[model samples]
Target: MNKTLVAGALALTLAGCASQQPAPPFTLTLAHINDTHSHFDPSDARLTLDHKAVFTRLGGHPRLLSHVNELRRQAEEAEQPLLFVHGGDAWQGTGYFTLNQGAMNADVLSRMQLDAMALGNHEFDIDNQRLAAFIQGVNFPVLAANLDASHDPDLKGLENLKPYVLYAFDGHEKERVDSVKDAGKRPVVAVMGLVLEDMPDMAAHTGNLRFEREVDSAQRTVRALREQGVKQIVAVTHLGLERDQRLAREVNGIDVIVGGHSHSLLGQFSNLGWADGAPYARQFTNPDGRGITCVVQAGQFAQAMGQVSVTFTPDGRVSRCEGGNTLLSDNVFYRDIRRGEQHRLNEQQTQRLKAEIASQPNIAMVAEDPALRAHIDKQYLPALNRAYGEVIGHLPQALKHVRLPVDGSGSQIAPLVAASQLYWANTPEVLAVTGRRADFALVAAGSVRNSLEPGALKEGHVGLELLPFANPISLVSLTGRQVAGLLLETINASLPADAHTGKFPYAAGLRYTFNETSKGRGYLDRIEFLSQGHWQRIEPDTRYQVVLNSYHASGNDGWSTFFDSQQAFTDRLDLAFTNGKLTAFPVARLSKVNGGGVQVHYINQPLNCQDQAVRCNTDARAFIDYVRERRPMLTALPESGVTLKRL
Candidate 1:
């Protein structure tokens, strides 16, 4: 009621309003890596040492740790909010993973102090049980937004796996009186995980853990986070570059994406006329058009690290991004020396850059962290030495990949795989069931990761080459129509994959005349199957027993044709080949070997898929067994004894 008091109160209110300000811009440095793939040891990098280019391996857990530690220190000095994250596939690909079954990588990654990681398909290579154990071992959050693991007793309640986490780094939230919409305190970051939708096709047994569509899961998650008043959102994904780009375009709330799984070297890849791409990070307009989204990925094998520097407005929109792939590659620097780029091994420009390398600075290659190296050498190498290096056999000649393994040509490994599968199909037990020998075996090129090198091939070498996916061997019955369809799909998968994709199917006891001209899954000109001792043109209605890896038998890699017409999207199938007749042994019934000692196994049994559990997984075991018993040494290709001709 007093005029003086009212004036005083008004003045105080005005003063408080004048002092309040809008929230200042926040900057964050997001460091990302993907697809380390059990490459515990450093890679052989090409570098310049002693004034000349030399081949040296770089990148191993030791250097990876060292490289990241140095970067963190640099980031701390710059006073930037830094977050270290992995995109996924930390398991499988090397002897280190094969021996420890990912436990070793888990401990090593934990030491790296990751803020978070997405679940890669390889994480499920073993089974849900092992995946649960791996999740338990790591200290960081393991995320998969679409995961539903409630049904399995081991993964119930889903406490161990989180879809999205309201994660915070070393940063602070503040009050912003200047803007009513921006006035609040929240954590520094919110990272959501989205894995590949193709996990069912990749893993033989995922145990009841189901994956929802990434976009659907992401939409729901973003809404939930936004409702909770969190602004900054990052999607750490294993969906690779193409899908991640699509995600950036489609998803509303995601600000940045750190991705993996295609092993794509986004920005750092040499444009060798292969797949060309933009530099490490690219910006896309959001689907809602409210903001811009940045996408980034580090190349596979821990050989490089992606650093994304982002500035965000108070409302969580990205202002700008400065990000690129840092080649921590200890391999030499020649990859950067574009062939005609003013400098070559014989060029004068080398005098300047080469001198820099020859001088005291000595072109810095990420030195292996002594502590991490010691851990790997002392604790890890023993198993690797015992399991991987022990000589399984000696090779007389190098088994070079002559052709792309896809389309059933290019690599000796393809034909060799067919021969190996055929041997197993013809084994006494399998022969007794179908009352006939298997017509042919189906093998997809992607299944083999590496080639058999010449010299004393070690058991660990085989494990690394084949990769340890415990996928079982399966026998299925298919009519000639289905088999022919499969062959066509295999051819269509061959070309673009001559060096990239690996869905091509190779066969033994089967030969096909392919007409590349007809195009689009109908490329097959003719297909033949081996009969009692001769090759016969396959009949469309005739049923033949086929031996293939369990992954394919279960209808993956474009082979959905394997299942009967009635079944689609079916899970946990124990499929048995029942109806139809084989031309070779049409008269013979189940469990009876007709003539020629070729009895086959028929299915009265449900197709319960089980782990082969050999010392080594993949066909590497069969390759080893075939080598020891049959050729003891490979002088040339087609060691499986089934060479082919195209008519």
Candidate 2:
């Protein structure tokens, strides 16, 4: 061979080797929001890293759009594929959604250009017709693999609701193959979605729909996507964090799981192998073993946006993943107040957007009437007073002021309502009663919405606070054993001793002692049921007709033990009571007696008002006098007459 030929061939061989090398990994960015629930603005307050609190000034739709646009700009500059997704519960929180059947919020969501969203429980609040109408207006796909809309005539039109979608970047294959063993270009990217299995029951009011098994639906969807020649897969799920993790571990072939529902803030990669005793064994190799599925979710209410970037190898395995939740309203992101005109410019820009939207006819409907709306100042006090008047015999003190933290028992008005219902049901028709049956109730400290001021209590305010959610009463038949099991579960679910020292159940016709340090859930040592003005032991084998809010009857508060017992004769408790007939119930007077006067014999702890911030420290007679003077109009009741009639 000649020297020239040899040199040329050698150069060609080296060029071929370089071309066969793997292509550089590309990054795909996913932005997500969940449980927005019509909160177009930031929460009650925005917190800083230094723990300094600042009231939010900019959180309306316009500001959010600006922020989203900015993030898209930055993502585009980075040459990353960006996909915007929502985790569900987009409608039915405030007047913006409820009053208009989610019309305004749907318009806003459409304008925002959501790429995909999962089905949330609240989406069904308005029924199937309204849900379908809302979905029809949205440009993006509403993904729910488990929901069977075939049976529902209203939702049958939502044929566009798919389990998954595939987005492919053309010409990516040639580059990837040239860089890796001289193969062809990379395949298309696919994103799948799954809704929670319990969505049907949870969202029963929204529509007449049903959800299938989540794991089965996910498996089927992943298989179909793989069959369609789409290798890169992303699962946007509304099954919550724990269930999402479970889905990731059980369902194979899924590359990532974008989670929602539980509202977890997950940006960094967390190993799901620990779930269900699975080991963190990498299933595929991409030069770097980044694992099979990457899961991420943003917290509820658009408080933060999640950014997840994943790199896929030519062979379709994830090489790397990185992301974080960006604080939309931080000092760094905003113009400093000290900047004066600059800050004012941002404010002006925000105001202009708000004005543009505010000018719309729908904005007038969004404005809530404080008079009718349930707020601490307007509704809770009156309801509390009515319940107290019906249950309590007399005011203990001359002033009869029920101080906040009423008895230093860590009980609240809701629990008191539960207790009152229990006490009311303690007749011959109701053999035995357990659960939240007390005139003086205590809910989880987290449940109390607000505190009352030192003044006369009114029926209106009490009604507002007690019945804020408009949940009706329910009655359930349970054996004595089942009742005892439920009490144990309630104690087990309460806060730990070291976490919050003072905790007590709201008492109606009963009082009990609980030892927080006890193990195995049997924390209640002695339960005393009041009979003929005396405390007595409750028999364990007798049947009882217990009355409670529908929320509790269904075992929402870790009272699953009650339902697990398979008791019979479950009925709506609301059917047993009449509205307005119990109007003169004095909550303040009841609080004054239950607040501190008599130490119920069961628990050694003395009843004293500890937390002044929440207790009702107002003169009962004076508050009633004040109510008479002000005479706020009563809310119009439904056609149901005022009488305690059983359903």
Candidate closest to the true structure, highest lDDT: 1
* True-structure lDDT of candidate 2: 0.49
What TM-score do all the candidates reach, one by one? 0.75, 0.60
lDDT of 1 by residue, 1-647 (tens): 99999999999999898779776787878888898988778654445444455443446677778877887888867766777889998988777887788789888998887878999877877767777888888888888887777776666665647887664444522221222233334345787899877666555556666678888888899888888777788899997677888888988878899998767666633321223445566889988888788988877787777788999998889998876765554423442323233333434443454455444221235777888788888998876777765565677655644323323346676677667767755766435644446678777766766555456766666656453564545555788998878776655654431122456666788877665553233356677887888989889998877766766665565555754331432222222232321111121122212110112222233322242322213355556666666766765554322222222
**In candidate 2, residue 273 scores what lDDT?**
12
RMSD of 1: 9.0
- Candidate 2 ranges beyond 4 A from true positions: 1-19, 46-63, 170-187, 206-208, 266-290, 330-469, 475-479, 487-538, 542-545, 551-572, 576-647
Q: Which stretches of candidate 1 lie over 4 Å from their true place?
A: 1-24, 44-54, 169-187, 271-279, 331-364, 395-412, 423-435, 452-454, 464-467, 488-502, 509-538, 565-618, 629-647
